[model samples]
Target: MTRPWTVRLAAGLVAATAVLTGCSEKQEANETLPTNGAAETTPELPPLGPEDFPVPAEAREMTPEGAVAFVRYYVGLTKFVAENSLDPEPLLQLSQDCRTCIRIAQSLDEDRAANRRYTEYAYEFTGYGPAMLDGETAQMGFLYVQGPITVVDQAGKVVTDRSAPTPVELQSGAVLLWKPEQATWVITGLTVG
Candidate 1:
C-alpha cells in the first residue's frame, strides 16, 4: 500500500493543477481619465468578491481554517502564473516539491523561449468548499472557479484569446499539507482532472 503521505501528495497535486490550469479570466472595464488636452482610457482590474482568493498574511498558523485560507490564497497565485507565466517568489517559498508549481515555472520558461507573453489574465472562485481535515494536512476538494486567458506576441499583438462565455468550472481537487515547524502549508500534489 502506498504511504499516507504519498497519497496526500497525489491528491494535492491533482487539486492544484485543476485550479492552476483554469487560470484564465479577464475583467474588462474601460475608465476615462482627463489628460493634458483630452481624455485617456485605461483598463481596470476585475472586481473582487469574498469568494476571490487573497494572499494570506500569515501562512504558518495551523488550523483547518488556515488550510482553507492557504488554499484560497494558492488559487490567486495560480491565476498569476497562468496569466503572466511568472512565478511569485512568495508562493515558491510555500510550495516545495510540488509538481504543479514546477510546471507553472516551466510554462514561463516556455513562453520566454517562444517569445510570447500573456495579458488580461484572471480567475474567480465560484465556491470555497469544506476541506477534508486530517491531523496536520487538509484536502480541499472540488472548489469551482472560472476565468479567461489571452496571449500576446513580443510585438504586442494579440495571439490567442482563450475566452468563453461560460466560466470554466474547475473542480479544483487540491490537497494541502501543513508544516508546523515551518509554519506553512506545502502543496504535495494536484489532480488536474
Candidate 2:
C-alpha cells in the first residue's frame, strides 16, 4: 500500500498544482481595488505575461475574499483532477493559455494508468502574496510555495507531508503566476514569483 504520508503529500501537491497554473481567464471590470470603502479600481500589474505564480505578501494588503477565492478555485480544480483522474484539466482550469496546462491536461486523459480512482481533495495554504485589485479585475502574484498537503479517502480522512511521493506538498517551480480576471481573480498565468 502507498505510504499514508504519501497520500497526504499528494493531496497537498494536487492543491498546489491547481493554483500555480498557466490558464488565462477573462478579466472583469476592476476586481483588484480594496473593498475598504475605497475606489473599486484595478491594481497596477504588468500585462498578462507568459509566466505567473503566487508570491508572498501581507494579509492587510489583500482582500480576504479574493484570497479565499483563489484558494477555492484551486481546490475546485483539484476536484476536477480527482474526478477525471488527470492533470491538464486541473491545469487548464487554472490557465487557458499555458502550454504546460494544455500538455498536462492532454496527458491526464491519455495516461489512463495515473490514478486508480477519484476521491476527495483538500489544501490549506499558509503563504501570502500581492493580491492586486483593479476595478473588478484582481491580479494576484502568481508564485507560491504551498506546503503540508493532506489527502483523505472518499469518507474524508487522510493526511501527508512533503517528499512523501504522494504529491502532498508542492514546491512550486520558478514560474511567475497572476490572475487576469476582472471580476474574479482566478489564477491566470505562471511566472517566477
Candidate 3:
C-alpha cells in the first residue's frame, strides 16, 4: 500500500538525514580533532594595507630599470585605485607632498562621497621614456592614454561624460625619490597634460 504524501516526505527526509549523518561521522573520523575537545577554528588573516601592492623586487634596485619598474607599478596602483574606487590612502602613501597626487586623491574621495564611479574607461601607460637618475631622485616621462570616460551616480545618473571619439593622449612625467629607509620610490613631483 502506498503511504500518504506527508508520510513519504517524512521518510525521505529521515533517510537523507541518516545519509548525511553517516557522511559527517566518516568525515569526522578522517579529520584530526583537537585534543582539548574544542571545536576547530580557522586562523584569522592579518588586515590588508598598502602592503597589498608591495614594491616589486625589480623595482627596488637603484637603477634605471628599477625606476621604470617603479613608475610602472605606480601607474598600475593608480589604475587600481581609480577602477575599484578604493581608499586613496595607499596611493597617497606612495607620494610625498605631490600636488597632482593630492588632487587625484581628493577627486577620488569626492567621487566616493557622491556615490559616483567610473565605467568603460581606463588609463593606460603606453610607453615609458628613458629614466634620468641623479643621487636619490629620478625623473621619467610616459605616454598616457585615457579611454572615453563615463561616470554614473548611485541612481545611474550620468554625472560626468567625456565621450572622446578617440582616446585622449597625455604626456605625463613623475619625479621620484629613493627613500633608503623604506627601500622604495616616492613621488615628489607629478605632472600630466
Candidate 4:
C-alpha cells in the first residue's frame, strides 16, 4: 500500500551536491502559512502533497537514551539476524517491518553475516519538515528513505573520502522510531514496498 504520507525516493543525483527526495509536509487545521505578519509561524514544515500523517511529540533534546536504544537495535538487529535464520523478522525490523516490506530479510541477513564489513545501508530522513512528535512511544518519520547501498569486498579497499566500490540494488524503506518504557527511539514498524 502506498503510504498516504509518502516521501518520494531519490537516489542522490550525481550533481555537485546530494539532494534527498522526501515529503514536503502538510499544514494542520489550526495552522496557517506564515505571511510574515504578527501571526507567528510554527517551527514545523507541512506534510507532502495531500497525504495526511499523525505527527507525534517532539523531544526537547536528542537524548542519549534514544541514541543508545536505536544503535543497539540497529546493530543487534543486524547481528541477531546474522546468527539465526528467521522468517522476515530481520527485514521487518530493518524496514520497519511493515506488512509488505519487500526486501528479503533472510537474504540480507546472510549477506551481512557472510560479508561482515562488506555491507552498507543508507536511510534518508525527511528532516524536520513536519516536526513530528513522538506518539505514546514511537516517533513517526515524516521522511521517506530511498537510498543506494553498496557491499564492499573485504579484499577490496574503499575509496578515501568517498563511497565504496561495489554498488548494489537500492533497498528502499520507510522507518519509524519508537521507545520502550525504558528505552527511547527503537524502530517500531515499517514496510518496504
Candidate 5:
C-alpha cells in the first residue's frame, strides 16, 4: 500500500508551507515588539560633492606626519581620478593657487572630454624629505617614479604614448597651507618634474 509520487510531493509541499508560515508569523511577531524607547538612530552622512573625497584623520592634523599623509592622499586621489576616468575636481579642490596642480587637473579634464583615457599610468612615492613647517605653511620634498603612460581614444587609437623601457624618476616639492576652518591642508605651491 504505497502512495503515488504526486500525492507524496503534494503532502511534502503542504508540510513545507505550514513550517514556512509558522516561521514567518514568529518573525512578524518579533518585529512588532517595542524597544522600550531605546531605539538607536543612525545619523545620516552629508552628501558628497564633485570635489569631495574622504580625508583620513591622520591627514587632518597640523603636524609633519599629517603633511606627509595629506600629500600621499592627494597623490592617491589623482591616481584614482586617472584610473577611473573621473573629473579632476577633487584634485582642484585640494589646491589653492598651485599652477602645476591646476595644469594637471586641466590636462585630465581635457583628456576626459576628448574620450581619451590612460591605459598604464602609475606612480610610486619613493621617499619623503623632512617637512618644514612655517606659521601656517608646510613644505616638503618628495621623490617618485612614474611608469610610462599610454593614452588611447574611444576608438582604440593611440593618442599619446610614452612607453619607454625604464620608468622616469622625478623629484618634486610642495608647499601646503593649513586651513584651520576646514581642518585640512591645501596645496599653495607645487613643482613636479
Candidate 6:
C-alpha cells in the first residue's frame, strides 16, 4: 500500500531549487492580504516528544556534538513548520545548497500563497547516528523520522493525508559540510526513504 504523509515528507537534501509546474499563478505582493496577529502566536500544536530533540547552542557549530544537536533541532523545526501556518523565510536561510530544504521552503511558500495549511502533523525519528567526519565534511548517518501527516484548507477541511512508517533501515542523515571561513556547519545533504 502507498505510504501516508507524502505531502508531509519533510526530509531530504535535493538541490538548491525545484522547478515544479502546474501550480497556480504566483500572487503579487499587493494582491496578497495579511491575517490578523492570530498566526503570530504559536498555535496549540500536538506536543512532540520532549526528549526526542536536542537543542542546539548556535546556528553553526564546530564540533561533532554540535552537528548532531543541529540536525535534531533542524528536524524539529521542519515538523513545526509542517504543522503550522507559518512563514518559511527563516528556513531558507539555514540552507546553503540543500535541494530538499529548498523544495520544502518552496512548497511552504506555495501553501501560503494558496492559503493552505497542514494539521494533525506528527513525526518520530527512528535513528540518529553519530557524525562521520571526512576532512571538513561530515556525514551523519542513519537518521530518519516518520509519522502521519495531514493537510487542510482555510475552511478546516482535510486535503491530503499520509502515514509514514518506520523504514527497514535509516535512509540517510543530514550531510553537513564545515566551512572554515564561516566557522559553522552548513546542511548540504539529506535523504528521506
The best candidate by lDDT is 5
Please provide, for model 6 over 1-193, each residue's C-alpha lDDT reduced to its tens digit, 9 standing for 90 to 100.
6465653463322221242332345855687578885667633323222334323445356676667766667777777766665676556655578998888778877777778776655665644555777787777755464545666777977665322332233466788877666455667877766
In each prediction, how many residue pairs overlap at the backbone (N, C-alpha, C within less than 3 A)?
16, 64, 0, 17, 0, 8
- Assess every candidate by TM-score: 0.58, 0.36, 0.68, 0.31, 0.69, 0.60
Model 2 — TM-score against the truth? 0.36
Task: Show where candidate 5 strays beyond 4 Å.
Answer: 1-53, 161-165
Model 4 spans > 4 angstroms off: 1-108, 116-123, 128-139, 144-146, 153-180
Q: 44-110 in candidate 3: lDDT tens per residue? A: 4332225656667777667877888888887787766766778888778878989998998888788
lDDT of 1 by residue, 17-64 (tens): 988877755656669755698657754333221223434544335766
Candidate 3 clashing pairs, residues 3+ apart or interchain? none
Native-to-model Cα distance after best TM-score fit, residue 176 in candidate 5, in Å: 0.2
Note each model's CA RMSD in angstroms.
29.2, 29.7, 16.4, 25.6, 13.9, 31.3
lDDT of prediction 4: 0.38
lDDT (0 to 1) per candidate: 0.62, 0.43, 0.76, 0.38, 0.78, 0.62
Q: Which order, best to worst by TM-score?
A: 5, 3, 6, 1, 2, 4
Give the per-residue lDDT of model 2 (tens digit) for 1-193: 8999999999999987777653454546776755678567755543221133222232112364455455444544544564555544435554546555565457445533533343433444433454555553444433233322333334444423211223244433212233334322444443322
Q: What is candidate 3's local distance difference test score?
A: 0.76
lDDT of 6: 0.62
Q: Which digits, one per residue and each the tens of the lDDT, describe model 5 over residues 1-193?
A: 6669989899999999999998878443465766778878854433222434576767777998888888878877777787778988888888998999999899889889988877877778744755788888999989867776677888977674423235788898889999887788888888777
- Sorted by lDDT (best first), the order is 5, 3, 1, 6, 2, 4
Question: Which candidate do you rate higher for lDDT, 3 or 4?
Answer: 3
